[model samples]
Target: MILFGRLRMLLLRTIAYLVDSFILFILVIAGFQCFLLILGLHPFIGRHLYSITGNELHLWLFFSVTIPVYMYYVTMFNTRAQATLGMRAVRLQIQTPGRMGLGKAMLRASVMLIPWEATHVAMCYPKPIWIDNQLQSPLFYTALGLTALYWLLPLLNLNEKSAHDWITGTNVIQWQVPTSKKP
Candidate 1:
């Protein structure tokens, strides 16, 4: 019975994650399209865009919007019962490993967003080069590798133990609606 329950919870969580990812993906794409449109409309705005180069403006746009959304979703949902959308859809809740608070959620989001995602991007580049004589590629690649490991922590729970849950001292629980007693 316990194993069954855990499996069900895992399935539900996976579905929720997929749904959330899809939504965020669409949002991020739309945001970038909008940014491009704006840049086309006002070329001057593009001149001030912060990027390694004008060619990389889209990367900056993606990071700017997606990171904040990711942080908000994880921090809000992981720390609280309802994530921005997933928990509410499934009627699920997140509980801290040791206690209830937003600190772990925030920390998790910060680590995943900045280091993990950035690392993945870095890995895409070939032949590192110094930017302003600074070695930035190595740092990003290292961060990417570590973040990938951290993200996989949840997968460890496939056998019923989550590294993420262990690290944050957190657990996701299924909420059962109470049946009314006979009057």
Candidate 2:
């Protein structure tokens, strides 16, 4: 019964994360479009798109998307609400041993993204992992395994804590709304 409840929580968390990611995707696209508009290059995207070199694209992606996403997690975790927009929607909040500060929130956010970074590194290698319908790169396999383990950590533990939560000493729990009595 306890295991089933934990699994349900995991599913809710996953749903919340997907919602957050979708929101971020839309926001990023809208922001980029506005940027191009401000630069007077919105109408020239088809022609000027190829002018952005691979390194430049990487830098833009890291600065414009990755950093903001990381900061979003940190900021939300440290807020009075103690939850991201999606987390709030799902009635979930981050609970810490102490009042979560900037440093702790940042650490939690960074640890959460490690698996993604590992996968990015694996894909950026010279040789592709998928060759002739088979995955041939050790690095890619390691990254894939780590990503699975990272998400599956909650299922392996009684506390229902993921790897990032354990590393940062935080937990995701159902949020309780305070009720006030009218005088």
Error of 2 at 117 (Å): 1.8
Estimate the TM-score for candidate 2.
0.80
Clashing pairs in 2: none
Model 1 TM-score is 0.57
- Candidate 2 per-residue lDDT, tens place, 19-95, comes to 88988877776776577778987543565554544445445556767787898889988998789999998999998
Residue 52's lDDT within candidate 1 is 44
lDDT of 1 by residue, 61-176 (tens): 44555565666666665543534476657776665445455667766555435654554355334421222322455756587567666555455555443555565556667654
lDDT of 1: 0.56
TM-score to native of every candidate shown: 0.57, 0.80
Error of 2 at 183 (Å): 6.7
Question: Top model by lDDT, which number?
Answer: 2
Q: Which ten residues in a row have the lowest lDDT in candidate 1?
A: 126-135
